[model samples]
Target: MISAEPFVSGKYLIDGNWVDAKDKTTVINPANINEVVGHVALCSEQDVQNAIESSERAYHSWKRTPLEERAECMRAAAEELKKIIEENVSLYVRENGKVLVEAKKDLLRCVDIMLQGADEIFEWSKAESLQGPQKVIVRKRPRGVAAIIMPWNSPLILTFKRVVPAILTGNTVVVKPATNCPLALMAFLHVVESHFPPGVINVVTGSGAMIGDVLCTDPRVRTVAFVGSTETGKDIIRKSASTVKKIYMELGGNDPAIILDDAILDEKAITRLRMGILKAAGQVCSAIKRIYVHESRYEEVVGKLTKEFQHIYVGNGIQPDSMMGPLNNKNQFDYVTGLIQHAKDSGANVKTVGIKLDPDTWDQGYFMLPSIVTGVNQQSEIVRAEQFGPVIPILPFKTIEEVVEMANDTEYGLRASVWTENEDLAILLADQLDAGAVFHNNHTIFQDLHLDFPGAKESGLSRETRHCGMEYFSDSYGFAN
Candidate 1:
């Protein structure tokens, strides 16, 4: 690890240069509050405006660049990214507080997205000749400037999914990094922005309240891409009305997992289920939020699942054996704690497990053990709300019909999963789920990338995009560079 110097992103990148800011935001290590992982420059409203203006100017020239030339530059950057992936993984662990394994995977995914995105976008965005009643020459055109607002969890991958497609299509972007996790992405972007032309890629760091409106409402930005809460997404939608921007949003999900009567509950299946809930300390938007098992197998399922989760090691991500780290921030930590408390108050049986790596200093970090709750009412906060923490509630379902209804009863529908040995039955049941992505055996696995749907009707045009290529949509093509 690079211990000699802690990562610092003290300048906002605007017009291809790192410009210093008067105010700054210090990123704290969620595993160790005393450690200042990094500091990001907090830009003002004027700074955001400058970024948008620069992106607008860049779009004019960038759109004229050859498609092959644009693809070539992005491919080279993807190669260079391989060199820094490990270093950024370490930095991500320190600043973001996810396990080292997940940190590496998240950073590595960024490189793949770029490399594959280049080819996919290249093919998709090229000019097309077609006959529809009469011969037509069709070419995709760039949408001018795009505003990409990201979240802290999976920072690099989340930001790049939008960034690569936007830039490859010749739309310049002003990126807003999450307040607590900007360090790694800023560093990653620093490497990438240099590969592109000046003003093509810009970044601004600050609270959404201070600068987000400017990014979303500005007419210069033709599209607004955001990944955050439903409430925030709605707020952006309201603001974008004046400008009528093309908005792409990936919001919250209380994804459900149904354990069929014939579902496999072997060691491997149980481990996968545990990771589904505990991964990123359950900060994932589409992670399994609630589980419904056949009433006959409810006790057995809880016994086996808790046994696996209880063995997971919770500690600082930098450690060798730390399987999972603390939640990324205090607000998230507090909100999760409140969720557990409320569930308990409502007569939910919460089984807290996991051995703290450092029991003597447990309070030093924003750590919470895996909480497996039972007896939770369908309407309780823990059951209904998206408890984005390492806490999951297991409910008993007597019939498939009843469970399907219970699973469909939610405002959030990012993704869901059904675990069963019955293949035909699984596919039939999956068709009935209201969730965008319904998996028979798994969800969020790399193999399941093609199975995911972009978004449910309730959630806006949001995709749980991990390892998704820019050519994800068969009919959709980019603006030819």
Candidate 2:
């Protein structure tokens, strides 16, 4: 068992003070389920009400604060977070079961996003004036209190991605981190809370099912920002309909990567594909879930991928040479394992790769080696569902037209990528993809802040990042003369 020096204290941040909830929930380390990382408060409905009321009371004053001053506070928070990145990275790995490298990337991305929000707020806050038959002025106003509901997969980044933008844009925020991995993010927020005024930022910890409806349906909360599964997003939309609140959802995605007949099967190309599937143990919203390779190169591509997967090292996050870590919780572990079994039972060619570094701890943890499933039916559960684990399905295609149709077959359209040496063909196939973001010769990952990162179709209801995101947190008012 790992040392317990960095145990997380179970407390909620309400009105700039650490307070306890009615009950507490223990957090387990996915790398070793026998290990207890810490505990978090399981807030009650009354606690949610208190948080919302506190945010409502602070919204007017915070929205009136100068944008320049708010930006300054954000910059200070970002710098303070940088100072604690190393410490938080260890906390992240222990709580979330991601390797050190992935944990570090998440920390860096959080800092980058905080700074980006500071810059974007200035651009998004600019007003517009026009003089013609009538003179008019339009300005943006904060949408009262914001409810930010985050997922566990990328807790730090997703939490801050909404929190930073909401507060910077003059909206007071109440954050709800996923119950499974709330410790790291709550600890990170503790460091930055001092930078903002009392009640400007608050976190409520508990079962989302118990308190999520309270946050969404509350009339005082003008904006609801969420990042999670598509089903949950739909429920939020339905609940928010009563109050008609502005909702920004970044839901689940089953992203696909296509390899053309003329695509290069070189090391770099294969590594890119491998990283797309293996990153965070494939527990990412935009991780490449499906791969459609031309029939001519399908066998060769699978061989290359299998060879690369053999070198992956799976173990506890703190292990020096470990490359991948266990799934974040038991539900996901069972879900992915069941999908793999179903595929095998259906005659799909399922192959497991990589070795479990600690066989003794395998059953004690939610660990699974990387797996590749080929010859899967297009309509199979493995193909239609989001595995959200370290398993990928590679399907063969005959023609560009057929592959394009297969790629766009799902209800999700979050992200897709095309691989080919021919620039003309790459662009041609990219344009045909139904996803919001398309990449050429690369897999989908975080995009630049300047680009819009919204999901199309059932993938999501709205967008995040850039000016588009800011619009979701503010309203426009017009003055005419």
Candidate 3:
């Protein structure tokens, strides 16, 4: 007897219909060696036009729907999304190469994000009443069909960040997920389509260069919410300017984590730091790329971190014991490995202290050993650039002001963390830091879904805030004097 496909439907969803693309795109499980786990239809220009046209058609009624009704639909969608968490969690681990446990957490986070938007963001959506003689109320309406270009890193959460909030605020969405990681988004869209009104949500997967222009340049697209590299974000901004649609961008980050001398080194702290640097193979946009340790504890910290790092099992995420998984794709793997090697070439001492990742299982896959590099010159590329990999460079610092200057020295400042026993110092450093958000005594990977998420300078513009989805979701909320 023969087995059946894990997922039978292999087409794109647009306007409440399962549609085919001009060509089929192969989706290989990142954990397995190019295993044909699933498939997604690659959208063409025509497909983009169709989805946008459908969104426009639905906007008239969707935007006009009472706030209560819209909120109910959002609640339903969130519930539906919650129900499929386990199913898509497995797909995320297999397709995106995240640890199976983390993958499950990612899906749960998505549901939590949606539920928050449904429960709280709507509370802010109501128009307030004035006391004097006149009822001047402010209301936030949907901006029409938003074009969300989601990144491959944490596909589920990134996709939910835009899709759930956009829809809950009455804006229809036409999503274009990164080709490298589209399965989770595709599955989530299916669940959403089943509950929401037709044409309210649509997902099309394909190369951005080809189909992305349609979303960026088209007049029908009222807003573009994107998460990716700074360069690509700029391109989207330039193109979308023609239509003058609102742009919300969450781009790259070269974040740092500071370890103060007074901080205690518990087993929990070392484990958290290790996970922060190596989670998702360090492909996370907010991963701790640079570790600035207090010179007093530098040696001890490195010794403890390396010892803990050695225990991580790297292999196919299907295995229960595997903690670290392979990189998303080959290009990312090569780029990350190149950065580590270049750091070594630049006189940085690189050390691998992880369960020896066997290459035999990844003959045609992307994989790398978790590594720590020390003796790195502060000015070197490894310390300065955003190497999105399971790697970290250690640099010693003596003074608080000195470390603060070093942390702000880089061009990218998306996020960072400060570990110190002194609450006053942590608060002071958090305020002075150039990054968007700073955590006290935590790794840079810490993310509260309800907080503001955006970068400064080259890191990007306008954050994705959690509680106040008002700014992120409102179609046009501005005041006139």
Best by TM-score: 2
TM-score of each: 0.94, 0.97, 0.94
Instruction: Give per-residue CA lDDT, model 2, range 1-481, as digits (tens).
Output: 4545343357888898889655898888898787778888888899999999999999879999999999999899989989988877877898899999889988898888888888888888888998789988998898999999998999998888678878888899999988889888887888878899999999998889977989998999989999999999999999999999998888888899999999888999899998888999999988899999999999998999999999999998878788999999999999999999999999998889998888888888888999999888789999999899999999999999999999999999888999999999888887888888888888856567545677888888765455636777888899998
TM-score of 3: 0.94
Candidate closer to the true structure by TM-score (higher is better), 1 or 2: 2
Model 3, position 221: C-alpha lDDT score: 93
Write the residue-wise lDDT of candidate 1 on 1-481 in tens digits: 3463333467889898888778887888888898877778878888999999999898899989998888888998889989988777778898899999899988888887788777776556656776566666665667788888999987888898789888887789899999988888988898899899999999999878867889877889888888888889889999989988887887888899999888888998898888788899999887999999999899999999989988988998888799889999999999999999988888888999998987887798998899899988688889989889999999999988999999999887788899999988888888998877787777564453222255575555745543243332122443322
lDDT of each: 0.83, 0.87, 0.79
lDDT of 1 at 366: 94
Candidate 3: stretches off by over 4 Å: 1-10, 129-136, 357-364, 444-448, 463-468, 476-481
**lDDT tens digits by residue: candidate 3, 1-481:** 2123334235777789977555776767766654766676777788889999988898888877876777677778778887778766767777798888888888888777776777776566766654555555555677888998988888888888778778777788898888877877777777767777889987777778877799999999988988899899889999999999988888888889999998878998888788778888898888898999999999988898888878878877767888888888878877888898898888788988666455667555676778888988689888888889888888899998899999999778898998888999899999989888887777653355666667888887776565534467575444333
User: Which candidate leads the pack in lDDT?
Assistant: 2
Global CA lDDT computed for model 2: 0.87
Residue ranges of candidate 2 with Cα displaced over 4 Å = 1-8, 130-133
For model 2 the local lDDT of residue 455 reads 81
Residue pairs with colliding backbones in model 2 are none
Locate the minimum summed-lDDT window of 10 residues in model 1: 472-481
